[model samples]
Each structure stands twice: as C-alpha cells, then as structure tokens.
Target: MDTSRLLRTTTTVIAAAGLLLTGCTTGGSGKLQTAASSAQPSPDPTALRPYYEQKLTWRECGVPGFQCSTMKAPLDYANPGSGQDVDIAVSRRVATGPGKKLGSLVVNPGGPGGSGIGYLQAYAGIGYPAPVRARYDMVSFDPRGVQRSSPVECLTGPEMDKYTQVDQTPDDAAERAELVAAFKEFAAGCRARSERVLPHVSTVDAARDMDLLRGVLGDEKLNYVGASYGTFLGATYADLFPGRVGRLVLDGAMDPARPSLDLNRDQTAGFDTAFTSFAKDCAKQPDCPLGNGSPEEVGERLKDFFRKLDAQPVASGDPARPLGEALATTGVIAALYDESAWPQLREALRSAMNGDGAGLLALADSYYERGADGKYANLMFANAAVNCLDQPPAFSGPDAVDSALPSFEKASPVFGAGLAWAALNCAYWPVKATGTAKELVAKGAPPIVVVGTTRDPATPYRWAQALAGQLDSGTLLTYDGDGHTAYGRGSDCIDSAINRYLLEGKPPQDGTKC
Candidate 1:
C-alpha cells in the first residue's frame, strides 16, 4: 500500500500487461487560444542562464525512433553556484510530419517517481495519436531523483519484499509499532543511500527543472500533457511560469488546495467508489469470487477476507514471499486502476480465495515494479521522497491515524483502514515538506484543459472540478466513465478533444462533458 497522494502512471501499464494474459487552475479567459510568442524572453533569474542555454545532444537509444539525452539542472535552484548538479534523463521522438511542426510537447506520466523517459520511450512517444505526433515532438524526462536522474534508493529487493509484507491495518499497539518501524526503516534507507538527492526532489524543484528543459529544448513555451501526479507537476509549472504555458493538458487532475489528510481521505473514498463499481460489475459475472451481493456486502466480504489474511497468510508461488493482507490489498487496488482489469481482478480474487496467492502477489509485485529477478524499481523510493517533500505528513503519528480512521473508513469502508495507516509512512520522512496545499491560478496562462473521469479511483473527479474552478483560465472536460484517467483509454470523445487542443490550440468548451 503506497502512501503517495497519487498512484504512479506506470501502474496502468503494469496492470494491463498482467491482464494481457488474463484481461487545474484557471486564469484569464475560459477559452484556450494560441500561446504568446516564444520569442518573448523569460523572467527567470540570470543565474540560471547556463542551465537554460545548455544544449542536449540526443542520440538513438531505446526504440527505433526515440532518442535519449541527459539534461543538467542545479541540485539546488536557489543556489545554482553550489557546484552540485543533477542530470535529468530525457527522451524524445521528433515529429513525423507532413504538416508544419509545432513545438515540443512535453509529457509526464506522474510518479513524481515515475520514469518520464521510460514512459516516453514506451508509450507516449510512439503510441500517441499520430496526427498530434506529426506536428509536435513527443518529449519527456526523468525528474530529479527518479530513474537515471540521481535516483533515490531505499531498501534492497529483499528488504522491500519484507516492507511490503508489513501489515498495514494494524490491530493493536504491537502491529502499529511494526508498521511505524517499517516506515522508519524505509526512510532511513533513503537518507542513508540518497541523502544527496533526497532533499532536492520536491515538485517545485521538478517544475523548475521543466522550465530549464523548455529553454534547452528551444521552446519559448512549454506545451505539455501531464497525468495523475503529473497534473500537479504541470500545474506547478504553470503557476511558476504562466507566461511559458502553452496547450497544457492536465488529465486525472489533483486539487492543489486540498491538505494532505483531506487528500488521503478523498482518495480513500475514491477507491471505495471504484471498488463499488467493481463489485457491481463482479456481481454480474458468473465467476465473481465474493459471490452475488450488494456492493456494500461485497466490500464487507472483502474486508472479512483481509481480516482472515491478517491472521493467516496464504501461499504464493514464491516460497520466500507469502501473500498477506497488505500485498493482497495492494493487488486489489492496482487492479482497480483500470476497469478493463476487472476480469483479471476477478480471477485473481478467485485464485486467492482458492489458496493460490500467486495471482494477487503478481499484481502486488507489478504495482511495486518488482522484476522477475526480484529487483524492485526506484518508483516507490522516489515516490516517497517527492511526496514527503511536497507536503507535510497526512498524519503525525499512529494516534492521529487512529483518530482519523473513522473518517477514512466513513469515506471507504473497505480500503480506509489500510490507506489511513499507509498515509502515516510520510510521518517518518527524513526531510520536512517544502511545499503546502494552495491554489495554483497560473494567472497569466492561456486556457488549460483539465480532464476528469467520473470514477477515477486514485484521483477523484471532484479534485478535477476543484482544480478547474481554481485555475483562472481552466476549462473542465469531463468523461463520465471509470478508470484512472480519461485520455488514451479508448474514449474517442476525450482523445479528440485533447488532440484538437494540442494541434489547434482550441480547448474544449468550459464545462464540456463527454
């Protein structure tokens, strides 16, 4: 159970791959228009000139058409002369064009820990709508402390395997203590291994890094598509450099004004909403594991199953790692990210109930990005680093979580207790938060499109509504559907609207619903 406010975008990729076997703020006018000329000089301090002017020598790397490069940014933006710098890993696929080429369209798939370069090379660069790709260069970068960009390392694979197995929904003081200790151990590992990069991995810093990338890419304005936590990153960029904003799309948006606890609670409710949807769907399926019942009954049964696991673990295929409540819950949450994964989740649940925990364990491993070799990706490590630095802990201690458990449970009867406890992980972070909840108006930016799916489990639809209302020029586009994000998920309505905006600079009408 990861404690981050937003799930990594890669979760969808992982979930889909597993199933393959089985299954922001307004300003200005409400209407989007062509961005101001890129020829206009930036208002950034002169101290950053070198970073802004640095050239990227891209060379072929991963896939056929994609190129990878390293970008340099100051480790500490306030002290560019500190001698310490971070190299941001970047990738791009130049426009395959017949039409006039638009500027680069930077994308972030939102892990704060997620590998933007990996996402670019894997999907966005090659899989995006070709018409849009024909006009704009598809670009992305690993944010500082992510992947090749001075990644934050925490536990070893064995250590992480043990950490994930720690019981998230503690039943007593001893269990609670164990959970806290696990969080402390994780944080200590990060401090010990990644101290140099840990303190500098805040979203604000990443947003500034985007500006540097923009200048290096020779774009006067930053055109972008940011999903999940990437939405927050995009919103931060717009807030910091509204003058440079161009055709920005924040899908599966986060409300910047929500405090950490509220965000957690809301997200808890979101998962419950998604689970209810899943339960309803499962009830209709012949092989539904929980059996036919109301969504509420289904949730209760699932909780009962978790309690059973809490008492006695199940055998997973890996002898070293048995399936427990934590991993099983994570597995369920991972499947909830995509409705298409429902069938997979159904089968996994059935298998888990039948004593074979491999299916659920596999889902959990995917969520954690654990390779078959048992090596875990840096996604979770960077996730905690950035999330802890971005906002204060949702709860200060176990007692706080206990007190708030009722609210969380009220929000989500099934996922609440575990998620509430999971939220406590940030309380032990080695670095204090450098940011806080606040509205991002991006006052001078042109119209930016904010898309929200009605049943997004990780990012609630209300957040999109709040963010759109907060932005002075925000235009809200709604997909009355399920899943984590709306775009690129088979919704022609959502895709066309975003494509039109990217290619023609005309945002969907404000409050448009598809």
Candidate 2:
C-alpha cells in the first residue's frame, strides 16, 4: 500500500472542461495548518449557506435496506458562487430502533478513494453490531472524487494494465525510463481527464464537504467511524468542527504529522512486519512454500521471486498480460489487509513460484478491482489525486529517490524500492498540494477512540498511538492481534468498548488493551 492507500473502493464521472480549479492554493510547506482549536462554531459564509441548508431527497437504491441521495458541494469552497458543483453520492440505512435513536453514525472505509456509500450499503449498514445498527441511522457518502460522486479519471483499462506492469525495480536505463514515463503518463492522463475536479479534491476540501453533509443530514453533531485514510479525514473534520463532533472512532489511524517520505517508509516497514508474521505462520503449514526458513531468509526468498518475475514475467492465463513484480507485490499487499487472506496468499505464492501466475494475478486484479472485462474501479485514480493534493512529493526525481534509497531499504529491504518509486508518482501530479501533514488535536471534541491492531500492515499500530496522543481527548484501544481494522473483525473487547462509547458516550479508558 502506498502511504496514500488503495485499500478498497471505486466510481465514475466526467469533470467539466477547463474550469478554473486553481484559485484556491496551499503554501506547500509540507505540513497542513492546524484547524482552529476553539469549541466555538465558525460562522458560515453567506454564499455557502444555501449548500448547508439544502434539503436532501432520499430514495431507495442498491441493496434493499439502503436509501440513496445526492448532495451538491461547491467544487471550490473559497468561491462557493463559482457555479461548479460536484455531486456527492450518499447512502443510508434508517435505524431499526428499539431504543432512543442516535442522530446518525457515518462510517468510512479509508481508501481516500473508498466508496463510503458502497461501504455503508455493503458492510456498515448490515455488518455492524445489531445493537449499534438498531439505534443510529447508518450513513456514508463518497468523498467528492470517489465512486458515484464526481470521480476522477486517469488512464483507460488497457493503459492502466500497461501502467501497473511497468518494471518498478528498474534494472537498466530503458527500464528506468519506462517507469518514469509510466508515472508521467498516469499523471498526464489524470490532468487531461480531470482538470476541473483535480485541485478541489484535497483532504481539507473533503473535510469541509463532510461538515456540509452533517448539516444537510440534520445532525446537530457528527458521529463518525473512520478507518485508515478515513482517520485522517475524520480527524480533519473534528479539528475543523470540534464543537460539532459527537463520538468519533478513528480505527487504524494515521499519523498526520509524518511527511510523505516518512509515511511511506513507515508503511514499507509495516508491510515488512506483516510479511514476517505471515512467514512465521506459513512455516507451520505443511506445504509452506517458503520452506521453514527464518523470516529474514523468507523475505530474501520473496524478493528473489519478485526479481525473477521482473526478469521473465510469468504467464497468468492471459497472453497479453503476465504477472510481473509490481502486480505480484500488490497481490501480496492485498492479502496483508486481513489475516483470513493469508492462506490464499500462501497458495498464490506457491503457484507463482512454480511459474503459474494466474492465482497471484487474480489476487492483484481483485486488489485493483479490475473486472473480467478489463475495466478498473476508479480507486487508484482518486487515491493518487487525493494523496497528491494532500502533501508535497516524497521524491522529486529518480536522483532524489536514489538518495533516499538507503533509508527506504533500511525500512523494508523487500518493499522499499518499489514504494519509493511509487511515491514518485505524486511528484508528477498536475495540481499543487493543498493539504499538509499536521498534528490534529480536535481540542474541544468529545472523547474520541483510536483503535490499532498490533500487526496491522496498512496503518501501523504506532500511528494509532501517535494520533491518540495528539488528540486532546483521544483514547487508544489496543488490539494485540493481526489484521487491518479491528472492531468488527471478531474482537469482543474492541467491539464492546466501541459499542459502549457510541451508545452511552462512555469512552474506554485511555490505554485500554483488548
């Protein structure tokens, strides 16, 4: 996963041609300005009042239990009257109350690109604890440039197929040039296809949009559960509107203070940690392909596999496209999200080592959400757009990457180089970053809960510790287990504490261990 993750999500929409989206700007200090710390509400500018006051008409859509709605937010909040509105796609499942209802409990499954509406409809609506689901209207909305919302588009399917296959670990000048061109091509395509919506899709802008959603939903205060990148988004919301915050849960939280380089390096180390755990578990299996080696040797063996794939891509049942190092690594990363996927990863790797790349390719395709028809979800496109606009580039060029290589390699000898190169993708972005890496205290907000799985591969546990320490009233819930987000993954302790927090406003004790 890029520090800017592609965990899971998708969407569709065309940006209007040649609209002026660059009026709003950031100082590019590489750190975001902290939101106002006071509990006092900020007055809404007159021109933007209409947006906050508009009535949303909800109608049934998608799964049977959910209602869908559309919202309009200014493409540029600074100039609300600009007449460029981006449609926000929202979905809700009304409370099936047996007790007093809580206004609304919004959930986000952190892609920076995850379709919040899809998450609501597919999992949060019906997947949450029935007791919790019974009292709060479960709601979610795709952020401005996510699925169903006015999404950002980049390359076509074939182009993306080509892009993902480009040799990430460049062995020669031609291969290095190909990697650079792939990043450039992707950046250029996004600019060409999404110029109007690109600049306004920053994290700050998305945070502002969440506030609008709160008012339009008639909630006096926002109740939110955000995981992964959503943690950053929700923290921004709480920081911006501390007075309007109710109970917020930031699970698998991110450390907003880390610059892109450190974030990526930490994440590279995170994947290394997760992979080591996987190797330990695999060694116990009778058919473990890694052959009971030490974790260090296992890592080198995996790296060796990747190098071999880079040299001679394996046939994946598709003649036009074979599984290369990039896709194989993505396949491995996808499995790291949840330990349940570990067995599948083991099988995939076993096959890949034997020269049949189909299983690994399938896993990679699933990670990218590519369909049999070769169409891709807008996940990666919007992920890059939001990420690029949130922070300055991690590396300016190949030379900069070379200089940073040792540190990254120290972070994760297996994944460092690829992730470092992946960071370079943002350097070529068309829009200047409008958000920054900054501490968020959300001073006046009610007690907020932050959950961290000890062996989480995406947003490491230390990030949760950092975020919890930063928030004035933040409490840390530790899950000494494996996987990404912990709440609904079968930890009674985690779920019970969070449930109590959301229901009775009784936050778990700080430093609570599950």
Highest-scoring model, lDDT: 1
Per-residue CA lDDT of model 2 for 273-321, tens digit only, reads 8888998998889888877888888888899999888888898998878
Candidate 2 structure lDDT: 0.80
Please give each candidate's TM-score.
0.94, 0.93
Query: Which lDDT values do the candidates have, in the order given?
Result: 0.84, 0.80
RMSD of 1: 6.2
TM-score top scorer: 1
User: Given candidate 2, what's the lDDT at residue 223?
Assistant: 94
Off by over 4 Å in 1: 10-44
Candidate 2 segments whose C-alpha is farther than 4 A from its true place: 1-4, 7-44
Superposed Cα deviation of residue 430, candidate 2 (Å): 0.7
lDDT by residue (tens digit), candidate 1, 276-312 = 9999999999999998999999999999999888898
